[model samples]
Target chain A: MTTAIGQYQYDQVDRDFLAARIEEFSEQVARRLDGALTEDEFKPLRLMNGLYLQLHAYMLRVAVPYGTLNAAQVRAFADVARRYDRGYGHFTTRQNIQFNWIRLEDTPDILRLLADVDMHALQTSGNCIRNVTSDEFAGAAADELVDPRVHAEILRQWSTLHPEFTFLPRKFKIAISGSPNDRVAARFHDIGVIARPGDDGRVVFQIFVGGGLGRTPIVGQELYDSVPEERLLATLEAIIRVYNAHGRRDNIYKARIKILVQALGVAAYRNEVEAELAQMDIARYRLSPEMVASIEARFAAPDLQAPEGAAAVLAEQRAQNMVFDRWVRSNTHAHRSEGHIIAVVSLKPPGEIPGDVTADQLDRLAGLSERFAYGELRTTHLQNVVFGHVRQDQLYDLWRGLVDVGLGAPNVGLIGDIVACPGLDYCALANARSIPIAQKLGARFADMTLQEQIGALQINISGCINACGHHHAGHIGLLGVDKRGEEFFQMTLGGRADDQATVGKILGPALPEDDTVDAIARIVDRYLQERSGQESFLETLKRVGEAPFKEAAYDTV
Target chain B: MKRAVRVGAGEGLVITANRLLDGAIVWLSADHTWQTAIQRAEVLVSDAVSERLEGVQSRAQADGVVGIYEIAVRPEVGGPVPLTMRERIRAFGPTVHPQFAYEQQEGAGA
Candidate 1:
């Protein structure tokens, strides 16, 4: 029998908490329908429960904390999709699941369904501390320093319905990473914490603050070199309290902690946080070593001993089938345990929405996860699913299963695997469409050989300056703008999100939507020509600079 | 006409709002009910635009219809076409997901 690892099990108290919330929201919905509550008053209530009024209908976002979910939860999601949404759900960059076509009237039922499955939409939206996200490969990755989900769960429990943070100047985002690779884009969050082993073999957190990507993109500053495990919550409280006091309240644009941190400078911000920490009772929030150990115990690694001769079998299968070979090379990642692999199931296909998955697809994935992945799955920041515990011997069968389901696309980290926001088509703030652009690009680079030759590249597209698609972190970024009632795109290059993160630089004047594909083609062609042997697109651009690319893009246009 | 002039769209106004109960795109009709059909929309002419817009606003507030606004539309042979892309898409649905568009439906409504 498979043991559930790192999955948060709700106790009777937890279930009661969510059930009470559902009843409260149900009553609130009734009051709003009867005109007892105005839309102004109801908006926050709905938002706190993760409901949003989109261009077409009310959108409901469900939290999958730290990107962890089991087979049953995934099946439940499929059921919700079939019953409530229009057959599909969109996975977001923050590792949350969003349904774009939900009706406001059906949200109460949806919450109840979610509560039944030990899940809730709590803190998925609203100004309070949103869902704590981490690397999709949290416990399973070989390179992880610690299981980040333990700390993430601790933060989740402490921060839920946090009274002091409910009405912050703007929304607050926190991300954690246990690995040095920084796969979760932790540096881009408002408060990014990285766990590392201290000198005494005890886990410590390296805190980062003020990093965000919106209209104003800024790389985070290092706040503390190392904070002890017990002091994490108190340190976080100090940082947030400082932000809550000094963050701009007058203008919506200047309200985020990133802006305040930028205004105060890293040194001054630290001084304020230090001042707050000095006055506060640190013992109140300090997690005891035993408490932390108990939390960590819940996330014990699966006893998955690799099967003997599995690698040889996998190697033989790879040599026989070229498609399987390419897929294995592209989609499967190195596993923490020997004779196993972490397989990324691509949600992106040619001429389809970037992060959308149908109900049938989710159901199949759930079944597959249970069969091959120890009944668990992970949602990545790139809007893809991960079967984090797949045995090497069963990979061929898993590949066949995925291929049958039309999900065997070998495009992870390739040009075809694009990150795009719901632009003008669905979002009210968008001036231009993002999906069509991404689709066109994906189609343009459909050749697997060409994609492999080009190497790792990220093309992020945003409909507006809100930067939901994380254009700032893309190697080749496209931001859609409206110029005189016409859709135009601005290109940026050389941005990356690793241990050393950097924001992209704008290329030049915006090009018409019709000319964007051609512009991108020219930029890529320039990189292919200028690159030294085995140099990546980012490396080539960094070496030759934007002048050559700009010359090719604008001169051709 | 005065309010239309303020927003820089001079004439041919159509009252639109999201239905409070379902959040569906709806137009204020001549009968004062929020109907899903764009063809059944009450298009206010030059002089009557301001007066009719105010009436629709009050009615919209009372009826729980949200984000009520007057959009510029040009009278056509088949139906009135919204001037801006936003209003046009609102009248229809997502341009990408054409199946979800109101115009593509059998009844052809929001």
Candidate 2:
């Protein structure tokens, strides 16, 4: 039970799989370089391998499965950043890390390095069931019913190189949460699965289908209230099969399963899935209990037996250092194990790109994770890192170390911690630059005291309707639009991505680029002034409605 | 004199595309070659914009250069300034990473 889960150890078969693909891609790349394969011919081949020609350069998106990474894997990422890319890598909204400045020739080597580390870029992009994401704290969270990663891993294995679903209507996303609290934004994914313990103590799945955010953002409708553990695969198959058969293929905009589910009312869609399931042999997809148990056994719980008086020591440190106290308050979460906490290392330092980590910083984080976090780290959907099993006694030391490495911002869920997509600056599909706006907002909310006072606000920014930043799910969402080719921003209020996931309502007319930060400040001010007692910004918005925020936002001087 | 080479005309456009090999920001040059330095851009008048851009696109298609388009630019003291903020950033590189910002290639000129 205590075996180290140093990434799903890629056996010889996995290695061979990657090796063959790598060889094939290398040849393709060479041919393309030597004027053999045309751009049209080479594009699909490159995209299948997780390569994209972005605004400036060829970007390589790597699959960091369920956002879990060991020290060595991280170091390899750092190496890739330094060697192949522009000294940095961006941890994307999907929990995958993308190198923005990858050269086409260097991609094979990068994939080789990733393969060596039991990591590969397969299904990170293109029309496939993409890198399966789950709760960053799946195994470690106190309220977890079951580790979602166990099933996530199962799905990863089942979906990897699957022949049938490779060329779907659009790229598919699946998310699993072990806990009721949806930390991975499960409601916004194409397939959302919740693992809950049954009365008999066996794990069951509650499945949601067609949940996605893009040109058309919609919360996934629940397809199955509770699917037996054995029926999970069959159930998922039925859902995907229905989607594949009926999903719009001619129109790229209307291709997602969310649109399909919406077009056919939930009941009708469910009926289709049910019909599909009825025709299928469910037993063939059913996993034996022993198979499930073996996967579960591999996810060994970290040794959390800290030295006695660890809590006392943490309290003493908190008492001695106000800064440390602020950090613990903002950045740490309760762990299932005693004397341990899930420590979030904020990537959103003031005026920095939300998820950009320098190679040097990544190397340092890798070392720190090895030293303090059981050689394991998890990248959150919020674009931050979580040390799942950091001892309370060593919290202060870890904080100090993180601060030295420029990863400590002490504003995990606060306004300063913004979630932004790489907009026009990097993305080809963007209308405005998200990073600068995030930088401006971060700077405006640089006051730690003010950020702490504001408390637990999710601010998400997207360059376009394709809400890669999950702006539709933000407490305060900023969508960048091109108003006659000039950058303008639309603000939305009251949206959230929890169990009660709601898409934000647009507040009034879109504001000019220059007016964005000021409007945000004004909105925050309204929330602060109008809120009753300890009601959060979202709570206040829900209670008093968006009128106050709208008024404050529109009241131009 | 030589018609004063009107700098701020509506079609004072530059053919810009990402390089085929590395996806670097490149512009069509007077010599019918691609240059990484936007300073070396060959601006075309209104009549030539479409034909020149089309020709450039065709030439670059096999080279793997993508998203070729004519970007409007106004002549500044030193070089042509891209009209939109999008093109400006693309011409100069990301504002966030100043170290990796587009630098003048050794032999390129305005």
Candidate 3:
């Protein structure tokens, strides 16, 4: 038991596969550049390799495989950003990172470099199954019953260019969580799986299907309470097979699995899946106990030993500085290891862009991860990084190091911790810019005292109705709209992404940029004024209903 | 500027596309060449839009460019400027990162 990855580091077979894929893509790029292929023919191929033609330039998304990264992988990303992009890369809501300013001619070489580090741009985009997302604190969190990374990594292997599911009705996304707290927003995926402790002391799968967010946001319903542990993959295949055969293809908007599930009721959908499962060769698809154990054994077990007087050291450090106390209180999450804590690094600094890490910062953080953690870093759906196994005694020193790199913001889970999408600034589909508004809100809540006063709040922002920023799951959701030639923003209140997932409703009319920021301030102020002792913002909103909030928002408009 | 033939759109159009090799924003000049600066672009009169757009489409087929389209623009003292905010940002660059904007280039004054 040590920080070293066990026997299953991406072996030579995977390396050869990535090299072959990159070689094939390089030839395709050459053909396109030589004018042998038109944009129409080349678009899908490029998309399959995670390249997209955005508003200004070509944007390339690199897969993170459930947001896990080693020190070398982090350093590799930094190299790509410094050499290929504009000194920085954007972390997406789906736990991947994107380089915004990439040249078509330079993509093949960039991919070749990524392949050298055992990474490639495969299945990050296109209509095929996207990157499988899971709880960021999968193996380290205290509440976890099973390490979802074991299954998520298995799915990453299973879905990569699967012959049957390569071309579905539309794009598919799957999210899983090992805890009931549901950090990965499982209820809002095409297929949501929860790993829970079964009666016989084994982890059972709880399936939720037909949930998605876009033009229509639907909360996924439970398909099964307890699927046998070994039959998990087979059951997922059955659900996707049914969706592939029957989902609507005429309209792109209606092509998602949620629409199909809604059109045919959940019971009917379940029956169809059951019929498909009955017809398939279930034995071939079954995940054997040995197979599961083998996957688990490949992942390195944390060798975290309890350090004596760690709690006393943490208490003494907190007593030394009030800022350190606030940061420890907010950023420290419970860990399964007794002497360790999960340290959340907020990418959202005072008034800066959320989820953006510079080349220098990435290089420094890679070194820091090796020292504080077991050279492992996890990226959250909320656009933050996690050092999953920091010993309690070394936390203050780690915090000092992070501060030197300008990433030591103590705003984890506060209103300052906002999730925003790349809006009109970079995306072609966006109607307005999401970052500037997020910047305004971030600036408004920059003060640690004010943020702590406001308490644990999530404010999510999206450029359009595509909901890439997970605005539908925010406590205070802001959706950008285009009113004629102008950019307007609409607000929603009381949505959450926890176990009780709920989509927020519209609060009032859409406001212009500055007015929208003011309206949020007014709403937050009203909550602070009328809240009971230690009541959360959502709790206060629920107690008083939406009338007071609605009144406060439109009071000056 | 004359009223556009296309309904629910602005008058006076300027052709824009991304260069195929690098995906950089290019504006069509009066000589039918793609230029990186909007100041070098030739805004088309409403009467000449149909013919110029046809020629540009043919050029796009042969030239190394993708996603060719027309942007709504009105004549300014220095050059033809994009009307919509989206077009303006695309013609320039992302407003958040001003250092990379086309307006930062020499002679393309912001």
Candidate 4:
């Protein structure tokens, strides 16, 4: 028997809560359909429930909190895809699933189905605090200091229907990281929480504020060096309260906490938050050590099995099959448990839409999860699925299963593994089509050997300046713009979203869609020439200072 | 004629809106029926385009469509075509997913 840990356990109370929410939304949808409520009034209500009317049809975003999902939930998602949406669902950068072709009327039934599985789209959209994201390798990764899922769950519970701060100037995002490597882009969130070793060698939450992407992409500043465990929630509340009171309400563009923090400066912002904290009853928001321990206790331990001589057998298999060896190396992470590995199935196939999984694939992956990972899985912000507890011997079988289902592309962080938003294709707020750009690039670098040679490059593409695809965080970022009537793309270089989080700067003037892909290939060729030994693309760019790459891109174009 | 659009092309105006019940893209046809085809839209060729637009906007506010606006079209060989890329995309479909386009669909795929 396998134990389910770190995944939120929903009781009857939680089920009741979801049912009530669905009932309320169902009534509102009815009122809108019957002409009792105008579209203006119903827009916010539909948005709160994660329903959006796009260029073609309605889109529904379902929150997978901290990217956690069970086998049953995956199957349910497959059902949603087959029954409600098109044959596929798109996983977003925020670790949420977006069904692109939802009808406005079918949303009530979708919510009811989700509620049956102890899921709902509350706070997935709207001005309220959205779903809390974290490292996908939360509890299973060997390098993690603490599982950030515990804290992420806390944020999810506290922020849901938070009446006081629900209607803030703009939407709020929070991300947590317990790993030394910041995989979740925590630094780019409105509130970034890093579980760090304090002076006493105990875990203390390092608080960051004002970091965000979009029109004004700003890296957050460390608000507190070390906040004690009991004070995490209280400190966060104070910080949010400050933003709610003073954040710009007039201009939609100047409404994010980043703008307010930039305007007031970090020092002055801290003083306001500190003053607010001093006045408030800290005890009310205190997340006591005992409470945290209890919550941790609620999580069931993984009943991992040890297969005799599994590693030796796997080594034999790898020796026989070089292709499988490359896949094993690229697609798995170091696990916390002995003889166990974290197996990631790539959702990105060469020349296909990034983060899209078909209904058939979802159902099959659910079965695969049950066989290898104790029926538990994770969705990464990079748009991949993780089987958190696979034994060494089971990996080969799992790999074969994935290949059969077409989820076995071994390029997780390579150039082929791109991040792109639904730009002009489905989104109403887009200037150009992002998927075609990704498709052209992915096709160019389709060869596995070529991608491996390119070595850990992220190419993010956004349809607009909104940065939903996180163009600011890519090693090679492409922002799509509409010049006159045609599509043009702006290129950026030397950006990364790891521990050393930094934004990419524009390399050269914008190029047409036809020329942009070719220009990027030229830049990659320039990097191959500029690099010394096994230095990364970022290292090469940082050393050469965008001069060679800039020349390589624009000169040819 | 005087709205949030770039002035271009030849002929006239056509009222387009997302039908309230299902959010389907609909165009005001020659008989003032809200049909799903842009080709069937009534093209107003007269100088009283502003008055016609106002009447449509008011009627749109009170009825079956929510986001209602007029599209500037050029009378092409096939039918009246939207001037801007935005309207053209709206008229045709999303470039990436051609299957989801209104024109390409077999009765809008249920």
What is candidate 1's CAPRI-style docking category based on DockQ? Answer: medium
Fnat for each predicted structure, in order:
0.55, 0.58, 0.67, 0.51
**Tens-digit lDDT string for candidate 4 (B1-110):** 44454445466778778876667778877665677878777887555556766776677645567787776788877777887666787788866666766673223311
Which window of ten consecutive residues has the lowest lDDT sum in model 1 chain A? A1-10
What TM-score would every model get versus the actual structure?
0.96, 0.96, 0.97, 0.96
Any residue pairs clashing in model 3, and if so which? none
Candidate No. with top DockQ: 3
**Tens-digit per-residue lDDT, A1-557, candidate 3:** 23343213677788898888888889999999887888899999999999999987899999888888888888888998999999998899998989999999899899988877667778888778999998888888999887788889888888988999999999999998898888988889999999988999878999999998888999999999999878888899999999998999899999999999999999999999899888889999989889988888778876888689887888898999888898998888999988788899999998999999999999999999989887888888899999988999999999999999998899999999999999999999998899989998999889989999999899999999999988888999999998875799999898887789999988988988878988899999999998999999999999999888898898894
Using lDDT, rank the candidates from best to worst. 2, 3, 1, 4
Q: What is the lDDT of candidate 3?
A: 0.87
lDDT of 2 at A340: 84
By summed lDDT, the worst window of 10 consecutive residues in model 2 chain B runs over B1-10
User: Which residue pairs in candidate 4 collide?
Assistant: none
TM-score of chain B of each: 0.77, 0.80, 0.79, 0.76
Q: Put down candidate 1 lDDT per residue, A209-319, tens digits, no spaces.
A: 999999889889999989999899999999999999989999989999999999989999999999999999989988889998887776646779877998888999999
Residue lDDT tens for model 2, B1-110: 22322335443778888777777778888887778888888877767876876676677755457667777788776678887778888888887778878886533421
RMSD of each: 2.1, 3.3, 2.6, 2.2
